[model samples]
Target: MIAPVVSAPTVSRGVRLGYGVGSFCTATVNAVPGLLLLYYMTNFLAVPAWLAGVVVTAPKAWDLIINPLVGRWSDRTRSRMGPRRPWLLAGACTLPIAFFLVFAGPPLTGVPAALYVGACFMATATAYALFEVPYKAMPGEMTHDYHERTSLLQWRMIFIGAATAISGVLAPAIVSSQGANGTVGSYRLMAATIAVILLVAMFGSFFGTARAPMTGAPEADRGGWREQFAAIKGNSAFIWITALACTQMLAVSMMLAAAPYFAAYTIGTPAATQTLFAALVGPMLLTMPLWVRLSKRFGKRGAMVLAALLFGGGTAAAVATPLFGPLYAHLTILVVGVGIAGVQLLLFSMLADVIAADAARTGKRRAGVLTGLWTAIESGVSSFGALIFGVILSLGGFIESEPSTPVQQPDSAVTAVLIGQTAVPAVIIFASVLMTLKYRLTPPVGPGPDESG
Candidate 1:
């Protein structure tokens, strides 16, 4: 006999849009820092490359502690605004200010500047945990249908594409417009402009998701941390998917951290950073529907495997960019972007499935804690990309200097940038494909109540 098919109620389009808009805050916050912070630290603030990497990565380590706490807190919260939205409002009120302070462009340089930026970054991490852990948990609770979850998350992918494209291109363009070398003021302006965007998006999400449905208990499991850990340990699908996602996120992070350096040293123009990001994010916007269909036809697991290959292959091909010129590099990155659309859409959709399944099986409201663990590990692993790349740059003897004094990078340093951007990320993404193969999540095989009613 054929297995019974299970589905949840459809989410409203307005709710989807309102929820998806939050990606503007999430995508821009992630993109701008990964793209520019490393370059900014070494080139603009005159912090040593290795030290700057530590400064950038260290703050995110706080996610290990804060994300789970936020998750558990929100799960148990009882309020008129809902368990998640209050934290969303809190994040909206705080994160942008902390984010802006990170690039405030103070007079201090070297260790002092690193310390200042690190502290600001830590605050941003805390605020982000407040918003993100809960925000991420919503999709799992919003709908019970597996395919519908993919459809809902498709909208999120679109906003992520748009936000990443806008921030990646706009931020670099703003930096380049100030001067070929980029002044302190250029970074400050970029930060301020993006901060406004973050505020609008975060606040918009708080109000937008007002009508979201929750399928699980209104309050979460009151069990302590050990029980939460036990629940996580038993979910095989969550374990595999988290591993796959963390690997993919690490590759993306490394590429982002290396983008500006790749543009300046490999492609021979800082302006190329805009064009490159445009290439990388442009396909993400145009190809999302295709990915949605592919997931439907091939299944999320099959589609994810295909996407991982495309991403890894493109990244590997980009290793020869110096030989073929900028156009070739952009084309390869475009391919990577197509794969990225699928990867981003499927990963979150699958996570929602895992969350919904766990809730149904256990009859507990644990979306918050599950999402908390996912974000904590993902965020921490992503930060390592910068740390790893920084060590590579240091190994190549990369020089650090202020914007007022541009210095010639050694040939080894340029080679290190290229290798870190292309070969290293390609290897990591390929590894993610292997992890994806180990994931065998199928749709839930039953019906559910209409929480959206």
Candidate 2:
């Protein structure tokens, strides 16, 4: 028989803010690498585009193993600080240092440079899994109210927007300030600054949710990996959402990886990277409330379909950037940003619902394991965005060069950048819209439980 829903208390404002703060770390770490790392490897370090893509993607492949293990480890921990916070603390301590090293810009080029960046990035990915897998699991355990989950994640979406905007604008601006071509010294400075931000945000989140609620009892030593996989396989909602999220992430990653090339070749200025990112994220800050209300009116599945259409449409229209110029590209990306707001808000909220419902049905603490698997696949699939874009660049004969010695890209390479950034992503995002149609879930409901002290 199915267990009754265990009503969870509402999260307090301070705690909510603290939990939301973690996105500063998650968003920056994700955004900077996706936006600049590929360009950095190819342009600054002279790594071939294909090899650079491999370096960026190879480490995230480790996530498939590490994320689930971290998840299981967190699920079983008996900590006074709670199951997830200790891991958050651990990630806070490690990730910044690892991140700093990824862009330290060692005095090396080509293969050696690729190896160095790869090793450092692997470390970053591992540290990230420690925090993100368990961190994602928290909302499910925090509350059982279906609508409350959306309300709680709204704060997360807001923070995501802010963090993404800051990182997106700041990183490129720092790099561009050194030179239109960008020097190694400039990247080093950007990495160090971003690392400090990561430290503050990760630690803030570690302490912020000190008194956050948990709806279910801990199930440490619950079964082995086989059991976890079986549980995940049984959940249709989990599967569909994971598929949908992976497709969306891949599209976003591709656009991020191609941004610098798009700015330099299509938009006619290296600094346009900053403006494009600004356009891509500005709607996130302004339209979050609209997305939230839309979810309420149409339901998440319906809203998700609408959002995907907007994203796909905007991305497709951006293909005309070369013909219409920078203004057209920015306008199109602004529309993409509006859709992104809804897409980001609804996906996490839906995941929380799925996890909460699973707990109610089975009386098991599976959030960690489930989230572990979800993050693993998400990270792995998203890495392909860079890989795919790299292959496109290679096919178009993109030349590798040092920052001090800039190379003129062939017209084919420039064309590849435009298509990879816009058309490919547009196709992929529309495919995600089709996947969204397959997701079906009924939110769990019950009387409210007593508030956590």
Candidate 3:
């Protein structure tokens, strides 16, 4: 039987753009840390690979706990400004400070450095949860129209692509110019700059949505964690989507973490970090419109499966770098970026569909709890990208370099970097593709919303 259609207000373009600006913050957060943090600690600061991985991932551990609590708090929250905005604003204020500090570790070394980074990063993660949980909850609350949700989120993805591209290209250039002896010198400058931009975006969303209508899960939908857990757990579609999201994030993170290593060893130009990100993400930015059209034409899942295949193949093409050259390898990754655009475009929009459906069927707004859990996986697993690659690098006998002195990695370590950059991502993306075939959710199509969006 067809489920009953749901009703919710249409999201205005200005509001969509404002809400979408929030991506400027999130994309940078996702990009810089994944792209450079572990590299900074391991290569620039001479921290051991395994230790650096731990430092990067440990802070996100708090998300496993803090996010759900924040979600619940937001769920139970009462404010004229709305439940989510206060937290969003608070997070906006603090995230930049933490961003600066993550790269601006003090004049400390060894275990102390690791501990300091871990502590500061934990603070960063907290600030991120404050903004992200509530922001994510908004779409499900804002509209129940499936197609409109896709269109609304397309703008968000565009911003994400733009922000990530900006971060990817600029961060490396800034850090390279600012770094000396492997330590972040004026690196805090880049962090501070991006932090200010994040503040603006976060605040833009907060004020833009101020006059917008807000929705909550009906009281019937409110329940203990057990009940909340069961709600998402019982939903098989959510389970599969979370797995796909987690694995896809891991693949993306691995590539970001490996970028420095790839540039250093394989490309023989670590400074080519700029070229690497530009080549990879440039295609992503350019091809977003094509991906959007594909998603609209083929349904999100079908488009996602197609995207996964392209992503896997495109990344795996790096295996041919020895036969070709750096340019070819860059082109290969460019193709992967195109595929990433598809996954990025469709996945969250599809999740909103699930949330909307749940709200309709249960007469409740549980976006907070569901999104909170989803964020835990997203943040936690994505953070582990560094950890997983670190373990592999450690196992491969990778050399640790100090400030101003680039170490010559053993051949095994070079091999490790290549595999981490290419094969690892390709293999996991293939896994995601296989899993998507098992996804059995009712595709979003056919007649009917109960109301306009």
Candidate 4:
């Protein structure tokens, strides 16, 4: 049954700006690794394709354990700054340090390199979890207005898309100009800058939002680890959405991981490749407002479905780019970017809706738990995607010592790599469409009892 919509309290302009800044900061953290880590490892560090993937993927797998623990702990946390804020602060402070370590290029020879990468990645991922989970949880508690939620998310996504565009586009250029030796330095500086920005935004949100008084069975509602697992198992919609998120993230990660290779080999020049990569993400930033409008008109689900179709169609069309020339290829990728823009913006909105639905049904706010589970799943799926792409590159005989001469690689291997980049992800995104169909939760009503907390 469709439940009555709850009116959300009006949020001030300051709160709105705070939310946007917070989102921007969080998104900058997310965008850096996904867009540039693979490129750094493969191109700059001389990490082997297979090992590069392992380094990229392993830390996310660690999140399977870390995300939930943080979520549950936050759920039980009671403090003046609010349950979610302390972690947000702690995470913000730690992130730059951890991030600096990840990109600092620690010694790598045998097990030491592998271990170093893993350890650094683990620290970075943990810091992200602390910040991201709580940051995501705050919106639901801030206001219950359905449209207000959408408006808040819209602003968050704007900053998110903007941050992603700037970071994704600029990071490669920075790394490239600095040369391999300077790559670590560039990253360190970037991390420091981003960290300060994120800290400010996080604090702004913490201070700006009105903390809804938590009256009901506070600490008791904070379920144990076993109960959290059980809750995840029980919530069909959350599970399905998470699975869809995982699949989409995998596809996106694979594409981002392989973008440099595609640019260097398929397109012919690293300079050209960087421009192409910009083309891939550039339109996304410009058209975010359009996607936001579309979502409002079509509803988040409809917008998502449309995004999957366009993204899949564009990916498939990209396969013909060899015959079509770079111009057409760029155009096709641009179209794919547009599709990605919609998906990227809408997905979080839908997630917020799901969380709100769950709260309404249960009369409990466990946004931290839900966001944690989602982020955890996303981390693992994304890591697996990177790992798979790394393996594909290795098996295809792609090398980092010199630019790939596409003619040298066997046609069959090249075909496999291309399929992994374009076709496989397209299929995964298509499958994700099906998963979303099962997400019956809507923003107005909150989640049903059957929904996962």
Residue 83 alpha-carbon offset, candidate 3, angstroms = 2.0
lDDT (tens digit, per residue) of candidate 4 on 11-130: 667767666666755666666776667666665566676887888787887788788778777877888877877887888678767876777765444346556767888898998888
- The candidate 3 region of ten consecutive residues with least summed lDDT is 444-453
Candidate 3: stretches off by over 4 Å: 1-4, 179-183, 213-220, 443-453
Instruction: Report the lDDT tens digits of candidate 3 across residue range 354-414.
Output: 7776767666667777788888888899888889899889999997776768777789998
lDDT of 1 by residue, 32-130 (tens): 999999999999899999999998799888999999999999999999988989999999999999999999999999999999999999999998898
lDDT of 2: 0.89
For model 3 the local lDDT of residue 261 reads 82
lDDT of 4 at 356: 66
TM-score, one value per model: 0.96, 0.96, 0.94, 0.87
Q: Could you tell me how far off, in angstroms, the CA of residue 35 lies in candidate 4 after the best superposition? A: 2.5
What ranges in model 4 sit over 4 Å off? 1-4, 107-111, 179-220, 400-417, 443-453
In model 2, the Cα lDDT at residue 357 comes to 68
lDDT of each: 0.89, 0.89, 0.80, 0.69
lDDT of 2 by residue, 1-453 (tens): 122345569799998999999998778988999999999999989999999999989998899999999998998888799889999999999999999999999999999999999999999999999899999999988887777888899899899998998888998888877787778999999999999999999999988999898776546548877887887787888899899999999999999999898998899898999988899888998888888888889989999999999999999999998889899999999999999889989999989878776776676787888899999999899999999999999998899998678778899999999999999999999999989988777543355322110
Each candidate: RMSD to true structure?
3.1, 3.2, 2.8, 3.8
